[model samples]
Target: MPRNRQILLDNRPHGEASTTNFRLIAEDTPPLRDGQVLVRHHFLSLDPYMRGRMNEGKSYAQPQPLGQVMIGGTVGEVVESRHPKYQPGDKVQGMGGWQEYSVVDAGQPGALRKVDTTHVPISHYLGAVGMPGVTAWYGLVKIIDPKPGQTVVVSAASGAVGSAVGVLAKARGARAVGVAGGPAKCRYVTDELGFDACVDYKQHRDATSLAGALKEACPGGVDGYFENVGGLVLDAVMLRANAFARIAMCGMIAGYEGHPIPMQHPQLILTNRMRVEGFIVSEHLEVWPDALKELGELVGSGKLRPRETIARGLESAPEAFLGMLRGRNFGKQLVQLV
Candidate 1:
């Protein structure tokens, strides 16, 4: 029997993630059953949502169980099969996770896809045409529902999800304003993505100044808010929403760590008749194919561009994931397995 390496959650962090929280160990491969197929991982996606799973608390899904493989989405190739549905060399995508191989059941729903790489980069299944891409499309179309000529504000503007929202909003003829952490991301959002304006959130220490900065950026007031960070940035945006504004509550990266005591701004919602709704990608899966077609065309035509910060090898997964938590990586963070 051959053995494969798997990464497990050794411990949970208080505020941020570290290499010590993860344990990489070798495990034996059990025999494939009647309906299982052996998968060789090609790419493993590291997303902000993984941070929430590391904690032992409530979220959209149950927190990852202790001593178990850290759950994630991956694009893989079929190496062996015990099921009729799959054959060797078939490329597939699923929740195979951070490991060299996995025994996936072919009968399992959404096991993977037998795809050709000629259309686009195979790794894109974990990125632009994959989960992150679909996540961005769903948040903007199904949630924000932007109107032409309206102002749409996106936090973490240069990231995978943020970039998707900005491009889609602009395509709809809405004015897009990006809110990012530094000057580099600000430039990428405005210059590359063609956003109407951008705000650097790192410069402002508190909500008061942040709100003032946003006011300067969107003088007409914000008609749609695609929120990523949830601490002071969210508090600041609350102050500037236009009447009947719609807020697409995506991931709350700011609140993923220790619970920070943020100022309450529910009154803004009440006074403006704002509709702020929270959503997860799974809830909108039915509309994903349509979103993918739209985004795929944009990518094909060179109108929608995606940025990625790649790390080589499976061993570097822990480091790459930690760097993302600390705001160390730019664009969509990914691990390329060799």
Candidate 2:
């Protein structure tokens, strides 16, 4: 019997997710059907969105069921195939979940798409040149519509989606300002990521302090806001926003712990005449082709540097995920399964 190592959701976390919510197990790999392909996952994408799925209620997607493989994006090689489209040694991307191996149906739409690693690395298909990259494109291009010489502020600016948001804003001739958790992340955002400025949120925890920091960083007032970390960060930006400003409300990691994060300034939305919209990247699949093309070119040319904080193995995923929720990981979090 072929054994497959897997991680299943053991507990539906009531407040916040921890290692206790997950368990690792070994299972026998079933023989592939005629239309099936066996994928040996090389890299597993660990995203903040997975946190919401661990909860009980449905917000945007279905809640992750207990005693099953944790859901996520995976980039791997096709090891065995009884399918017509895919054969052995082909690199593909799929929803392979958290496992050493996965058997997927080749007939499924969006099941497996072969990727080109000649110009770009395969792992990037899980991050920059993939979901996070296109997500940044959709939020920036379709929602924010940042123009040259405008000031754009990105929350959680050193993480996967947020980091790409800042880079995309800058590429479009906007002054990018990032908000991160600590001084180191602040420095990385400014010095390395080439943002105009960065505010260390840890230094200014309260709403008053955060507002002051935003005031100094965005002197001309913010024209565009790419929000990934909600809570006080969202509240702070609203204080000094330019009239008719646009905000792409992405993720709210701060309130993901089942806490209510009331916006301190609802009147600001009215007074500023702001456009606030929230989106899920998967819903806007039409733009992936163009988004991926542009993002891939930037990444290939080293213009858009995609950073990763890779954890060693599958067992490290639970700890890595927990740490990521706490803002410990700097960039795209990945568990290198192979």
Candidate 3:
């Protein structure tokens, strides 16, 4: 058995998460039991949702237990298997956590899924063609549902989920606008990801100023919105939203650090008669087949090209995750464990 390296949640965060909140350890891999498979992880996904799990509180999901491996998605190869269904060298994806290896019970439904890297890369099973892509699809297709010529806006538009949202909207014949932090990110959102226009949120100090920039980008009032970073970004979008506009509340990264995010004019929802829906993608498992099919086709056809920012080594996961939370990553933040 190979030696396994893992990072565990050492403590819950008080205000903001830091590397000290995690502890790394090495352990000998246990022999696989009947119907068990051993996976040697090649890539680990670092997402913003993990930050929310670091705090002990009530959330859509259970809090990440202290002293346990930090929960995350992983893509890897099956090295050893006692299960009849799994064979050695098979590419698989699962909730392998922050570890270099995983022991999965193959009998458990959805515990391990074989992936075909013929068209889509295996690492992408954790990003564009996996959870994030499905997240974007559900928010935009189910909630926002933009029409042709309508303007759709998404915050954190250079990120994994937001980038896909903009492209998917454009495929539906809607004009996609983006709001990102820096000029480089904004440029990539427009030029690379094919967003119609992008607004640099850093240039604006207040929501009013940001809203002004949004007005310029979205000449036609925003008909649909995908909210990732709440706070001022959400405020700005709300100000420019058209009557009967739809808003998909995906994530509020701005308030993830135990901060209060008060809406300046929440009454705008009532005034505009907008439909605002908050959703958890996991809860909508019924849509996964349809969503993954469309997303897979888009990626395989070179229509939806998503980028990635990778950190090498398992030890790099903490800082890389922190950098992603601060918006330092260009695309999907991943840790290369191999």
Please give, for residues 1-338, the per-residue lDDT of candidate 2 as tens digits. 25889999999887878899999999888999999999999999999899999988869999999999999999999999999999899999999999989999989888888999999999999988888888988999999998899999999888878778888888999999999988888888888778999988888768889989999999999999998888888888999799999999889988888898899989989898999999998999899999999888888887777778999889999999999988889789999988
lDDT of 1: 0.85
- Per-candidate TM vs. native? 0.94, 0.97, 0.99
Question: Which tens-of-lDDT digit does each residue in 96-146 have in candidate 3?
Answer: 999999999999988999989999998889998899999999999999998
Which runs in model 1 stand beyond 4 Å of their true positions? none
> Considering lDDT, which of the candidate structures 2 and 3 is the better prediction for this target?
3
Q: lDDT of candidate 2 vs native?
A: 0.90
User: Which of 1 and 3 is ahead in lDDT?
Assistant: 3
Error of 3 at 148 (Å): 1.0
Error of 3 at 120 (Å): 1.0
Candidate that scores best on TM-score: 3
Model 1 lDDT-worst window of ten: 111-120
CA lDDT, every model vs. true structure = 0.85, 0.90, 0.95
Q: In terms of lDDT, which candidate is stronger, 1 or 2?
A: 2
Give, for candidate 3, the lowest lDDT window spanning 10 residues: 298-307
